[model samples]
Target: MADYLLESLGLLLRWLHIVAAIAWIGESFYFVMLDRSLKPAADGDAAIAGEQWSVHGGGFYRKQKLVGAPAQMPADLHWSKWKAYTTWLSGFALLSLLYLSSPQMYLVDPGVNALGSDQAVLAAIALMVLAWLGYDLLCRLCGFREGLLGALVALWVIGLCLACTGLFAGRAAYLLVGAALGTIMAANVFFVIIPGQRRMVAALGRGEAVDPVPGLRGKQRSVHNTYFTLPVVFAMLSVHYATAYAHPHNAWVLILFMAAAALIRQFFVVWHSGKRAWGLLGVGSAILLATFAWLAPTRNATSAVTPNSAVAAPMHATELPAADTAEIQKIMKLHCTACHSAQPSLMASAPKDLRLDEAQQIERHAALIRRQVVDLRIMPPGNITSLSEAERLQIARWADTLAVDPAFK
Candidate 1:
């Protein structure tokens, strides 16, 4: 009952996080597009930097970018900070519930690092905090040099990616990096962007010449957040694909993925400014293709041979071995049935409704099993059941046989 309740709460938090993130990202993108698409003020007002006209939902709207304080402060000004706050809050809650609450299962991989559950949770929290601090420091120190600052920020993210992949399970590492980036985004809003805007508003209300520096700083952070959107979204979604997180060179894979997402985002940003940079899209596609190639499995000639071939060898590369059904069942019972059974001991219900306790169910999920256990090697997450490489190889061999024979199914 407790597991069910926890799962239910996790689902609710995830829904809230997704909804808030969408609202925040949509507003951010719309504002960026509006900024880039703006033209000179029609009346040649020196105080107005630019202006844009648009029709939305059957209503025409004109938005003007003010250089400094307007003559009077507008009442009932809407603030966009709450979307960011809600996203971060809900996301952190979900992370605590699903991962930190059971760190050994999701956050820590003994194969990667032997961190205790409590230590792993603390480390994860520390990483998010440190990520914000490091990124904020970089912006403060190098805010004047945009190009150099961008390069430095990229290096900082790469460092975080390496640190995460080295310290935690692949799934956790990817999500941690996402969480770190999310923390940076929300911090930009809460600590820098929103505060700067509020200060400018206060100055305007006091009939003083509003400082342009605060507005400039807010714009800079807002632009940075836009560029981070795609990469952060990719990182959050990547946990679903074992091919990415479970790759032997997962850190490099993650770095490449982030680079590709950034490049693609840059293309859109450039397009919004009335320019076409096809090269950015081309390069991003090439990087994605390269990553796909890197993650592709290598087929071995010996994989097709029967396990009983030691007695007599008469096998061609195309001739697949007869898979040992008993051995395959035995392996699944040992490593998979714990969490994947109908009445799971570890959880209230079978994860993903995958029950491996029976032969029919095993056969039904053979391809999924092969992908998770053989190709990706991410089953029994954190190697909680002590699944060995040899056992994985046995599953791989069994899977190869299934491809050539219909009887196995």
Candidate 2:
């Protein structure tokens, strides 16, 4: 019952997070496009940097780019901070519900490093805070030089990816990186961008000239947020693809993927101004192709016995004896029941309601077991159950045999 309630809460929070992220990203993209597409006014005004005319939803709108704070402050000013705030809040809630609440099952992998639940949660929190602080400090020190700052930040992220993968499960590490980046983006709005705008508005109200530095700084952070969008989206979506995160060098996979996403974002950013960025697209494609080639899943034989022991040839499905119902039930009990049974001791809930305790239940889930265990090798997540290659083949052969048997129905 507790698990069911948490699942429902997670769903609600995830929905809210997605909706808020969409709104924030849309606003960001629209403004970036507008900024890039702006043209000098026909009748040049000293205070007008540029202007854009557009039609949306059967309504025409004209927007002016002010060279500085407007001479007369508008009575009503719209702010874009709330969308960012809501996204971060909802995302954090989802993270807590899904990961922090069940660290052993979702966040920690004994193969990576044995991290107690409390230690892992504390590390995750520290990662988020430290990432934001490092990024903020880097921008403050060198953000005036765009190219240098970009290079430095990229290095920092790459280092962080390596560190995270070393400490946490691959999927968790990727999500942590995304959460940190998202926090930086939102913090930019809350701590730097919005505050700067408010100060400008205050000066405008007092009939005092606004400092251009704050506006320039805010623009820098806003542009950084745009570059982060594609990478963060990729990180969020990568949870579904276990192959990428389940590899030995999953950190490299993540870093390369994020690099590709950033390059693609750059292509779009430049393309918005009628500029061709084919080079960026080409580089991104090459990175993705290389990643796919390197990470393709293929079964290989590596003897598990001691070096002094005689190594027997690996077994093939054809050489193995026929796997009957009894054999299938035994294998399922040995490998899957700890977490998939009705009264699971290892996990708070039976994942996906995949109970393997009964014969009928195992037969009913035969196809799914084949996919997750035989094909993907992604179940028994983190290989926590110590599922062996021979056992996986046994399950596969059993499922195939069951498919032809009339009793399987």
Candidate 3:
């Protein structure tokens, strides 16, 4: 019952997070597009930098960009703030519910780190906090210089990727890094962008000459947010793809993925500004191709067990027992079915709906099982089932035998 309730809460929070994120990202992209699409007004107002005309919902809209504070402040000004706040709030809530609440199952892998649940939760929170502080400090130190700041920020991100992959479970590391970047993005809006805009508005209201510094700071943070958007989204979605996060050198995989995302985003940003970005697109595609090649599963070339043992060492399918269905079933029930069954005893749902309740079901998901269990070693999450090296070899042997089955081909 507790698991059920927690699952429900997780689902609800996930839904809320997605909705809020969509709203925030949609608004952000729209504004970016609008800004790039703006042109000099025909009836040039001296205070206006650019203006855009659009048709939406059967109505024509004209939006103007001011060089500085207008002669009079508008009484009805809309703020694009709550969406960001809600997205961050709901995302953190979901993270707390899913990972923090069940650290043993989700966050702490005994193989990766011997951390207690409390320690793991505290460490994760600390990382998020420290990430925000470090990023904020870097921004301040870099000032408004885009080239220096971008390089420095990229280095920081790579450092965090390495740190997380070494310190936490693969899945946890992936999510933690994502959370760190997300926290930074949201805090940029909450602390720098919105506050800076408010100060500018307040200055305008007082009929004082608004200082350009606040607007400059706001624009700086906004640009950073745009660059971060795609990378954060990839991190959020990466939880389902075990191959990326569960590799031995998962840190490099993350760095490569982030680089690809950033390059792709840069391409779009430059293109939206009416610039050609063939180099960015080509580099981004090359990175993706490299990542895919790196993530491809390779069969273990060596086995740890002796030849005379009941379980043969990891080898080609010809060496494996073809009629070991009963033994394989026992292994699945012992190590897998607790979480991957229709009536799961340990968790709320069968992850990815790949159940192991029957032989046919197992056969259907045979390749996926091999990918998650043998190649990536990400299943039996957090090693909660204590799936041993021998057991994994056995599963690998079983999976290898599936190649003879036409269905598998």
* lDDT of predicted model 2: 0.82
- The lDDT per prediction is 0.85, 0.82, 0.82
Q: Which portions of model 1 show Cα errors greater than 4 Å?
A: 303-323
Candidate 1 lDDT over 141-183, as tens digits, reads 9967999999999999999999999999999999999999999
lDDT of model 3 at position 280: 99
The candidate scoring highest on lDDT is 1
As for candidate 1, its clashing pairs are none
Candidate 3 per-residue lDDT, tens place, 59-128, comes to: 9999999887778887999998999999999988998888898898888877677888899999999999
Question: How high is each candidate's TM-score?
Answer: 0.92, 0.86, 0.92
Model 2 root-mean-square deviation = 4.5
Shift in Å, residue 320, candidate 2: 8.2
Quickly count the clashes in candidate 1: 0
